[model samples]
Target: MRIKQISVSGLFGIFDHVIPLNMDERITIIHGPNGFGKTAILRILNSFFNSQYSELRAIPFKHFCLGFDDNTSIEIIKNTDNSEEAEKNNIVFKFYQPYSEPVYFYLKPRKIRSDRGFPMMFLDYGIEERHTPIIRSLDIRTEETLFSEEAVEHFNNLSFPNLKSQEEPNWLEQLQSNIHIRLIESQRLLNFVPNRSSRRSAETPSILSTVSAYSDELAKLMQDKFKEYGTISQSLDRTFPVRVVKQQPSTDLTDEQLRHQLNELEATRSRLIEVGLLDKDEDAEFQIQPQDIDESTKNALSVYVQDVEKKLSVFAEIASKIDLLRKIINNKFAYSYKEINFSKEKGFVVTTSYGSSLSNSKTLLPTDLSSGEQHELVLLYELLFKVQPNSLVLIDEPELSLHVGWQVQFLKDLQDITQLADLNILMATHSPDIIQDRWDLTVELKGPHK
Candidate 1:
């Protein structure tokens, strides 16, 4: 979708604004000096395209645009053959707002003939994705209606709740998981572990002492590779590789060898106890026999089993998508082409120009790749996602963690890809190097350009 015009009565410092986007150019650059409300422009455009529901969260009261008291109007649509007919466009978004008292926030492409009569045909571009019938998640089970309440409810109940009903179901699920994973991964879990000194207690290490202690401990842990040790612990706890043959302890074992022997033995004993090999009396307990189900409980059990089965089905479906995504990513970025390999352990692994794994060690993560490679991989995947022709693409901050040379080269390559895919990319960037040649479409952001 392309935006034709955007007008804001009051937003940020702007009292009244009108910006007509040129659709002929593939890219449109909003050039303004620092503190000239360039970022505000992007936000306005984003708010315009996004649902009113979304806008409320971003800036409530309809008249309030973040720091500004304003009413905003945006017009977006496919350019038709007849401009006169387009002027009388039927598009409208009207909905109820719990935040604002009494009535719904009314929006229409054209001024209504009468305030009393509201058009039903116009799409409701509420922040809630479910507000629009066209944008709602596809429900293959029901064809009678465009909007499936049952499907929506079922989707709402997913592990990842749908923030917007209009979003594709799988998209919501993946998005939730992605956000969860990112949050958990981004947390830099730092702590002070007191040194093994007699005077240094866990609770009372001084700031300087704590830093020194943590560094010493971290150094030793890194040298010993505690991550591998943790992996072993997890494997043992999970009973992975369920059975193992025990190797007899050697008579000439060293201290390290003895420690390994004891750990292995302890792990075996724990597994044996879990498997019902030993009771509290040091006697072996046989597996218990299955009990017969009663008629009443049998029906309940069946229902309970069905519920569990459904949960499992949801999990299996999500896992399948992740697996499929991983496989596709791997094949697409394999050594032969982009030289990026994907592993659940490594994420996206960038191979060296010499065809070696980017990480020197097998145990090291794929995220260990240089910033340039990571940015390239991110760009590659984002572009690859738009398979459909004439698809609208929204990219926030396209110039993330990349050198100027790479950014220029990447943009040049992306232009070629966009041509093939027939994709219209609406990218937000602060890089002059990337869009310098396409200056007409470049929008300078507020703040120091660097």
Candidate 2:
């Protein structure tokens, strides 16, 4: 269900571009001069799959098509005719598959009366000025635009009813369900969250808050895994004696094999403790002597090893993600004299190495980090913790706020993340440093003449 290719015609009424995703690499970079529609393409894909229809209607493109790996394609056609009647049924989505009839869906237009007066009270509202047909026809007191494109769209959906039912066809719905898309915009620092006390007003929180929240989330997740591990340990401990009594020793269960398994389990436990998933066991230093184990004891130890492995398996996925995050963050933060450590109580414990001579270190808050550091941490955390597996993540301006060194390393880090997270990345960037000799992965958006 992966999108193999993306094509758009008459983008900004000037350019047509075709972008083929590097399916094997599972990453695609789109680069071009400014206003060449790189971000718009990402937005269009996100808008279509995420059902943000307002964006689709706003972005100027005659036809936008997504070709899938399964030989199916979806084309969105916008009627360019300027007539009000034609504008009512402006957008049509067509889904095509080989050896099957193409399915068509019309985007139902929101009906707003022409004589409706613009609400003067919403003048102070932070809405953009792109007027849809519904808003354009409204009678206004002032010449200045009242709302942003997105704000206008939101208002229209709330104020007006559709001419017909807005229900999508089952096939279209199922097709959309199969593919997942996440857009990580360039403005990554601030989040507009609804005010808990009031629905209408919203609070803008910085990325610093996001990093702290993620830290707490990771802590909670680790605690939950520990609880699950404890439960599994108890369940296995209850059945251990019975299982050991019934166990039959075979020639395959060698002494060396048993010792190796025990050592591996200890190693796994040590790793878990290091990653903050488990508490350090002070009495965990005992090692089995080869001579001390008889046939009966070997059987019991084998069962014990299996049970421990089962318990530790619970931390496998989260441990890997956390370990990678630590490695990447610390590697970069090292240059800034900072270090990141994790704990069950604290999501991220950041300390500065500046006071080494005084034998004292300051524990800085997440917000204490520089803008670039915050950007790096927030972006990585979102990739590792927030996004689901096998999703298409559209990152706009990944090079934002990153140092040139960080920018150079961005692609490599992203490659590592894509492999670990099982994601397909399609990012737009202006920095050649971010591309860093991997121009082979890029799709350049050129003008009609170029």
Candidate 3:
């Protein structure tokens, strides 16, 4: 799944533009002047491939076509007003007008021949601003936005092309489907694209902290794998003191299920200020306090806090999986992992031994490592361990923490890894060191008009 070309129009700062890509190289680079929409091109491709049109809401579009290696295309023409001509090609994407309640993904799934339409399944749909109206995992069919779940199943049920054995970018997410939209899109690549998750992964030293940060930032609230893992179990209830979750007067419910119940409640003083369908303020204790609130309200708050604790443990379980220091030292790091241990009695110190000879061992915390070594370990570890092959990796800027010499070798290191695993990299870089000698693969997005 290679993108051969893309053209965009009818958005701010971007005039008519078309990018005819040469994806023959395993590594592709996009370079342009300061304000030349280099990042915009990456964003456009990211949204297009993921079937996310939230960015295109209420905006008029002249033409947007995504060309593929198979000579097939996925087109987007906004504000169609039911035009018969545009309908001939079929609009694969649409957005809810005004960005109001119940934000929608209007995919016009159809039963047709080859090269006419595209199949899409998304891992993350950015709708947090709309408060997220939870919809079923299956197809959504409305008057303006309609599609049959059956059609989608039939599409994916078709034969898929055999996957190539080449290496790919590591952020590919595996989604179950009948359709063949196998390529993955992620906003994170080596902390270069400093989205919420990247910053968390970089700052958090231990695996437990890192996983918690990932889950919290992404808010993947309903994962169940944590239940099977006891590394973050309820035994902490006695070991750790009960700490109250911070509360706002505006927030009245602690249960996630109860939050939905609160949303359905009318904002009336009749009265309600919480997440429960029950006619009581679940957070009455936090809101009204010991002397002011009644017994029933305090009890409700107690029950709510317990539910919150159970839900929060899910985050702890996720954090437990993030400790890859040992894995990194074993794999990508220049040093070999002789032995590494964390001691609570020693004030939670990470000690590692690395060198050619066993007696040449050195013990040091992550803080003891140089900035370059730390950055290289974390970023390259994510590239090798966190990513899945055949992923379309997008890096905002690959030189954020490196020396000029390191910047020059960045592309070479990326190429080495990409070759080992079938991967594709499209990076937006300002540093010339990273772009030198890669002119054939570079596409400079001219600013303002081009």
Candidate 4:
């Protein structure tokens, strides 16, 4: 269900572009001059798949098409020439398959109640004039004179029951369901969240808050895994006596093999402790010698080894993610004299190595990091923890707030993330350092020829 090709006609009523995704690399970079609709294309793709129909109506494009790897395609056609009264039914969605006839769907715009003025949420937040640039850039249009551009943008991003039709076709629903898309916009720092006291009221929190929230979430996840490990240990310990007594010793079961298995189990436990999934054992230094294991003790030792392996297997998935996150974060943060370590109680323990002694070292809060550091951490966290496998992630400007050195290393970090997360990336960037020598992976959006 991966999108193989994307084509748009009459983008801003001037350019027509075709972008072929780099399936082999699973990372495609869209780079072009300003006003070339690089960000618009990404937004449209995200809007359509995410059911944000207002964005499609706002952006001035005649036709947009997506070709999938399964030999099926979906096309969106807009008729802007129609009168204002007839414009509600102007947008059309067409799905094309190999053998079946093309399916057509007419998208009807949601009608606003003029008597209601504007949503109270917008008024409370104070839709200032500063939002004009975002509205103009996004090309949001609303017929209501009272509705602010920021209000329209907010309404478009939200999931409203009245905005979507109740009678959606099964094929269209299935198509949209199969494709998963996440858009990470350039303005990634601040997050608009609803207030706990009232659902209608919302507050804007900085990325620092988001980083702290994710840290707490990761800590809870680690605690949950530890609890599962404990539960498994209890169950295995209960059944161990019976299982070991019923076990038949094999001729091939040598003491050396038993000792090797025990050593591997110890290594796994040590790793679990390293990743913060398990606590350090007081008796971790204890080891079994060959002379200590007789025929009868061998059977019990083998069973014990199997039980411990089963218990430790619970931490495998979370351990790998935490390990990779620590490695990447530490590698980048080391330049700034910072180190990141995990704790079962605290999600991320970020410390600075500024003082002469360990006692003088400073433990900084998540908000204490610079903008670039926060951006890197937030972006990586979303890719690794937030997104599901085989999803398409659209990053508007990954190079924002990043230093040249970090920008150059961005692609390599993304490659590692894609391999671990099993994701496909389609990012639009202006920085050449982000692209580096991998221009072959880029699709340039050009204007009409002279």
Cα distance off (Å), candidate 4, residue 437: 1.1
Q: Report lDDT (CA) for all predictions.
A: 0.37, 0.79, 0.44, 0.80
TM-score of candidate 1 to 2 decimals = 0.37
Clash counts for all predictions: 10, 5, 15, 0
What would you estimate as the lDDT of candidate 4? 0.80
Model 2 spans > 4 angstroms off? 111-165, 195-208, 282-292, 355-358
Which TM-score value belongs to model 2?
Answer: 0.85
Residues 35-82 of candidate 1: C-alpha lDDT, one tens digit per residue:
454444454444333332233223211232111112222222222235
- Candidate rank order under lDDT: 4, 2, 3, 1
lDDT of 4 by residue, 1-450 (tens): 899999999999999999999998999999999999999999999889887877897899999999999999999999877798667678899999999999999887655444444434332222234422111111124333233343444465744222343257889889988999998888776654432222223333223366777788888988898888878878988998999989888689888898778778777777777877777862353345546788768888878777877887888888988888889999999998998888889988899987568986789887789988888888888888888899999999999899999999999999999999899999999999999999999999999999
TM-score for all predictions?
A: 0.37, 0.85, 0.43, 0.86
**Candidate 3 per-residue lDDT over residues 42-63, each given as its tens digit:** 6655544443333343234555
Off by over 4 Å in 4: 113-166, 195-208, 282-292
TM-score top scorer: 4
Candidate 3, lDDT over the whole model: 0.44
Q: Which runs in model 1 stand beyond 4 Å of their true positions?
A: 15-18, 31-54, 60-338, 341-349, 353-364, 386-388, 443-450
Task: Count backbone clashes in candidate 1.
Answer: 10
